[model samples]
Target: MSETGRLILLGAPLGNPADASARFREVLAAADVVAAEDTRRLTRLARDLDVSVPGRIVSYFEGNEERRTPELVDVLAAGYTVALVTDGGMPSVSDPGYRLVRAALDAGLPVTAAPGPSAVTTALALSGLPCDRFCFEGFLPRTPGGRRSRLSALAAEERTLVFFEAPHRITGALADLAAAFGADRPAALCRELTKTYEEVVRRPLGELAEWAAAGAPRGEITLVVAGASATPAQRPDDDALRAAVAEREAAGLSRRDAITEVAAGYGLRRREVYGLVHEG
Candidate 1:
C-alpha cells in the first residue's frame, strides 16, 4: 500500500489459451509496463483473449533478462505498475523475471503473483506416484557429461524427482536418468500437457529409456520419478550371529575372521558384530 508501483508476476498459459486465468487478464490490462518473455506470444495471447495491451510492452527473456533487469527496475521504482509474463507457467519457475522481481523488492516496491497453470504441478498430479513429497529439477544440463554429473548429485536424493525436458532431447534425457537413477525406478513421462496432444506414459526408468530411444514424443515433456526406498541394514539376530560364529569356528576360522564374515554378510560393521556376539 505505498502508492508506489507494484511488480505483478503473471502466469501465462502453458499451451492452451483457455487455461488463462482472469487475474492474468486484469493484471495485464491494468499494468503500465508489461515485461513479456516473448512479445510475439504475448500479442497472440492478447488476440486470443480479445484483450488489448493498454500499457507499453517490453521484451524480457533469458538472453536479456540480466541486462534488461535494471531498466525494468527503474521503471518499476518510478511508481509505474509493471506486469511480468513468461512463455509458460509462472515467472521465475526455470524462467526469467526473477531478477527483476528481486530488484523491485530490494527497492521496497510491492510484488505479487497471479497463480496459474504449472507444468510441474500438473505432471506431478498425473504421475500416479507418491506426490506427498517431490522435488522439481527443472531441466538438466544440455551436455552429456554435465547431465551425468548433475544426475549423480541427485542419485541419492530420496524425494520424488520432477523435471522439464524438450521433446527431441527427452529420449536422451531419459537414457541419462535411467543410468543415474537406475533402470527399475518407476517413472512417468508426460508430454504436451494441457495441449491437444497431451500424453502420459508411466513405466520403469529403464523401460522408459528404451521406449524413448525407440520413439520420443514431440512436445513439452515433464518427467516424474519415484524416490529411492529406504533399505534399512539387515543385521543378524543373536541366534543367527552365534550360529555363524559356530560355522566359521568349526571351519578352522578365528573368531576375528568369523566376525568379519558375519559382519559383511549382514551388512553390519565389524565392531557392531563383535558387540552383538559379546552380549550374551
Candidate 2:
C-alpha cells in the first residue's frame, strides 16, 4: 500500500436511524473527508445519530460519482482518511462508491469498511420464502417488453429471487411477474421496511397482483419470488391422445390437422403425435 490515508466505505442506515452502527458513527465523525450519496441525507443522519461530522462533506450520487471518484481518491492519497457513505444501505449495493473504491485500490491506497444496515439482506430475512439460496435482481426494467423479457429469462431459475421496486410501478411489475412466472408461484412483498408503515405480504403471485391492483402500496418495496418447482408435466397416454385426435377430427378437421393441432397444444412433435394417434 502507498504511504497514504485509508479509504473507508461506511454503510449507512437503511430505514431506522437506530440501525446505524457505533463504528459507522465514529468513522463518520472522525474522517478527514466525508463523501455521501446525498449531503443533506448525511447531515440528517448525523443529526439523528448525534454524531457530529467535522470532515469536509461532498456529494456523491449516481450523477456525480463518476466525476467525484478521482477527487476523493486524491484526498485519500494525500494521507487523509476519506469516508464513503450512501443515503441507504452500503455503498455500491445498487448505489454509488464502486468508482472511488476502485480508484483507491488502483492507487495502492488502503481500503476498509464500516458495515451497517443493508436493505437487501434485511428484506431477504423478512421474506418467509426460502433464504438458503437466493438471487438479488435489483429493480425490473421500466418498459413493458423489457420487463417481461427479463422475467421470461428467469422462469427456470431454481433459487429464490429478490427485487427492488418503485411504489408507483409495483402493481404493473407484479402483474408482469405473474404473467411470466405463472399465477400460483409463491412470493412475498415487503414494503416500508424498518419503517412505521411496514407491511409484509406473503402469498401467491396472482393474489399479490390482485392486492396491488386494488390499491398500490407505498414506500420502499422489496419482492421475494419463489423459484420454479421444476416438476415435469405428465404426458398423455396413447389412448387419451387418440381420443383427443378423434374428437378434433369429428369437429370437421382432417386426421392430420387434428393431430397437428393437438400436438401443437401439447408441445409435442408431429412424429410423436402421429405415433400416438395411430398406435393401439
Candidate 3:
C-alpha cells in the first residue's frame, strides 16, 4: 500500500461542524493541498474546527471540475497529499470530486477517507426503515414527467431506496412516488438531518403525500422507501391484465402508455400486458 500514491477523500459534517471527526481535522491541517467543492464552505468549516489549512486550497466543483482535476492530479503525483472535501457529506456521493477520484484510481493512486457524517447513512439511521440492503438514488429529476419515468423504472426494485429531494418539491415527489409505487408502500421522510430542527416521519407513501400537501417542509430532505415485496408466482390473469389496460386506456392514455401503466401496476412486463391486450 505504501508503494502506491495516496489521495484523501474527507467527509465533512453535513450540518453541525462539531460532528467532524478527529482524523478529518488532522488531515485538513496537514494535507499538502485541499480541493474543496465550495471554498467558502470549507473556510467556514475550518473556522469551526479552529484548524488552519497550511497548504493550498483550490475550488473543485461541477462547473470547473474538468479543468481543475489535472492540476490536482499533478500535485498528488508529486507526492503531495491532496485532500478532497465537499460542502457537506462525503465527496463523490451525489457531490463533486468523483472525476478526480476516478482519475486518481485509474492512474493507480491510493485513495483514503476520513469517515464522518453522511446524509445517506445519517438519513438511513434516522429513517427507521430497512437499512440492511439499500441503494442511494441521489436526487430525482425535477420535471413531473421525467421524475415519473424515473420512478417507473425503479418500480420493481427489491432493495430499499434512498433519495435526496428539495424541500419545495417534497410534496409533489411523494405524490409521484405513491402513483408509481403503491400508496401503501412504507416510507420515511428525514428532514434537516443532524441539525437543530431535524425531523423524521415514518409512514405509508399515501400518508406522507397528505402530510406534505398540508404544508411544505424546510431544510434538506432525505426519503427512504421500503422495497417492493415478493408477490405470488402466478401472473396477473389475462382478464385482470385486460381490465387494467382498459381502465388506463379509458383515462385517456394511449394504448402504449396504458400498457406501460398497467404493467407497472401489476409488476408485470409490458410485453405481458401487450400480449394480453392483443389477445383480448
Best by lDDT: 3
lDDT of 1 by residue, 185-276 (tens): 66789998888989888776777899888877787888998776566347657888888877988986667656655654554555676787
Deviating ranges (above 4 Å) for candidate 2:
231-280
lDDT-superior candidate, 1 or 3: 3
TM-score to true structure, per model: 0.80, 0.80, 0.79
lDDT for model 1, please: 0.83
The Cα RMSD in angstroms, rounded to one decimal, for candidate 1 relative to the true structure is: 12.7
Worst 10 residues of 2 by lDDT: 260-269
RMSD of each: 12.7, 12.4, 11.2
Candidate 1 regions off by >4 Å? 231-280
**What tens digits encode model 2's per-residue C-alpha lDDT throughout 1-280?**
2357998999888778998898998998899899988899889989999999998999998998888888888888788999899988888888898888888999999899998888888888876556799898988999889999999999889888999999899999999999998876767799988888888886668879999999999988889887775652466888888898899789866676566556544545556878876775
lDDT of each: 0.83, 0.83, 0.84
